[model samples]
Target: MMRTIMAIVAAGLAAVAVQAAGPGFDPRALKAVAGPPNEVMVLGTPHLSGWPKDFDAKALGPLIDRLAAWKPQSIAVESLSGLQCDALRRAPFRYAETVETYCWDATPARQATGLDVPAATAEVERRLAAWPERPTASDRRHMAALFLAAEDQGSALVQWLRLDGADRHAGDGLDTVLVARLETLRQRRNEEFLIAAPLAARLGLERLEPMDDHSADRPYRNAEEEKAAGAAIMKAWDNAATARRKAADAALQSGIKTGAGVLALYRAYNAPEQAQTIYDSDFGAALKEPSPERFGRGYAGYWEVRNLRMAANIRDVFAAAPGQRMLVIVGASHKFYLQAYLDMMHDVRLVDTDAVLR
Candidate 1:
């Protein structure tokens, strides 16, 4: 018994020594040792689609103006890329629900441009490679059509919005049907359409990056498991922190009828304190729930995997051009996770959202 105890104590000391040594490499220590590091600003937002029907899109002007003033060379929105959607489409067994919920049908654009997702994606790259500094109306129209064909509606809308009012018509691969679709997208109540696409157009950016990842979505093994997991998570969320967050959101959203109100709402969403609030209310609660199947832990693990992949996607935008500024607009719950994941990169410098909102 004494020998076994000694062995256990020795093992504990070895574990401590390993923990103290770490992985022997720290990316944060590099800290822009090579050149100018990339600057990233993450803006946490409530889903505009959930707002009251009376909510005016114009209320976003002040918020947009402030983001525009920051002058991010690239804007990333919480949207899955067409390529990933295509992959998910092929494997419906694992991702049928995800594809149904998040992916759009590109068949119309495919028919208009005679290009599938992959071909259209390549065509978009080819056109941009030799795109003129001063492109014609026809050029914008053609590019918009290509973006639609690529299943990148956000970028397509950016191209469409960039065109003059008279120039937004059916031509250059954009059929009458496609033109109408663009017009419909223009009036949609989505943040990607109202905020990111418009901001990209205003900033003269050619495209908006869709960096959201749903590949980590785990389909439940059965209806029983799904129901139980849902119940567990909902029960976990019925806590004081979640209540406080809901109240705070209600207060902010109540004043979202004007530009200043919108700015204030955004400021509150991106405040430093929000990070802890979000974690405590959602993931943290989920992490501590007592479920035999560990449903809460599964939910928390999925959240982390999704955020890590999203951070990787955002980081990829600056791989070719390291020093550029990037603006990432995503749901409020994701803001803290994204920032925490991104802050670990060797060449990433996180910008304070409060400073920009101020």
Candidate 2:
């Protein structure tokens, strides 16, 4: 009986080894045979909204300068597209919380333009299809209003910023209220507003693509489950790795008074080692929690799904324009997953974030 069992185990091991070494289809292997490969730079950023109220937008100038030099043909920000938000609104049963948390109400803009989300989105496509080589200030103002009606504040800001200051007033489909809103968005602390929009305008790009995803968001079964899951995850995060991460972030943030300091913070956030550090402190720890409910696994699963969807959204943006240079600005934790997923594309060539920064 012992001899038979040993033989069975050996056969199982051999089968596993064979499976691991079997023929595989890797899209990356097709890169050499493809046309000019798409160049992608994934920039990991700390959400500017989380920074101190005293933080100055000018501190980002150096970082913006470097990115502008790279001259990406397309830019993707970590924002939910107006179309996605519209879909979420229709499925309140599954996405009520997500819609509430992430979707902007376009009622004001809708009232201003007499166009709903779908209508406004279609109008945007039509206008861009016929967009001129040199659009007038009036044309820009109209496009900005259309973007607002479509619930795409980031793209609206891109148009607003590209215009001369004299042209950024209430006219050409923009009412006084909508103009005020655009001004407010200009002063917003979010990275999409402060960094991505300005960079797109500076680079002479027409629009910024919103690639964030919240489709995986779901409510807990009950208050008890929610509390239990939160506690378990917190417990997992109380290890030495968490402490080290926090310490490093605090140190970097303390030096953000200067542009060089801000650049340094970005450098640290995008360092190659950050992937392992983040996994150790957050996802890896949650994955190993000892909860019977497997709450940690649930959290990790949601995270992976969200990242995968974000990657897909990004891919969809450059799909029609092969070999386009693209820049993705997202939260630091998402950098590793986005790079890994995007690197699997047949024609994508990942640019070194560190090299770009330098």
126-160: candidate 2 lDDT, tens digit per residue: 99999999999999999999999998999999999
Query: Which residue runs of candidate 1 sit more than 4 Å off their true CA positions?
Result: 14-21, 33-35
Clashes of each: 0, 0
Cα lDDT of candidate 1 equals 0.93
User: Which residue window of length 10 is worst by lDDT in model 1?
Assistant: 28-37
Q: In model 2, which regions exceed 4 Å deviation? A: 1-11, 14-23
Candidate 2 — worst ten consecutive residues by lDDT sum?
Answer: 28-37
Model 2 / residue 230 / CA error / Å: 0.8
lDDT of 1 by residue, 1-358 (tens): 9999999999999999988886778787778557677999999999988999888999999999999999999999999999999999998889999998999898999999999999999999999999999999999999999999888999999999999999999999999999999999898989999999999999999999999999999699999999999999999999999999999889988899999999999999999998889889899999999999999999999999999999999999889678899999999999999998889898898999999999
Tell me each candidate's RMSD, in Å, in order.
1.3, 1.9
How many Å off is the CA of 145 in candidate 1?
0.8
TM-score of each: 0.97, 0.95
- Cα error of candidate 1 at position 126, Å: 0.8
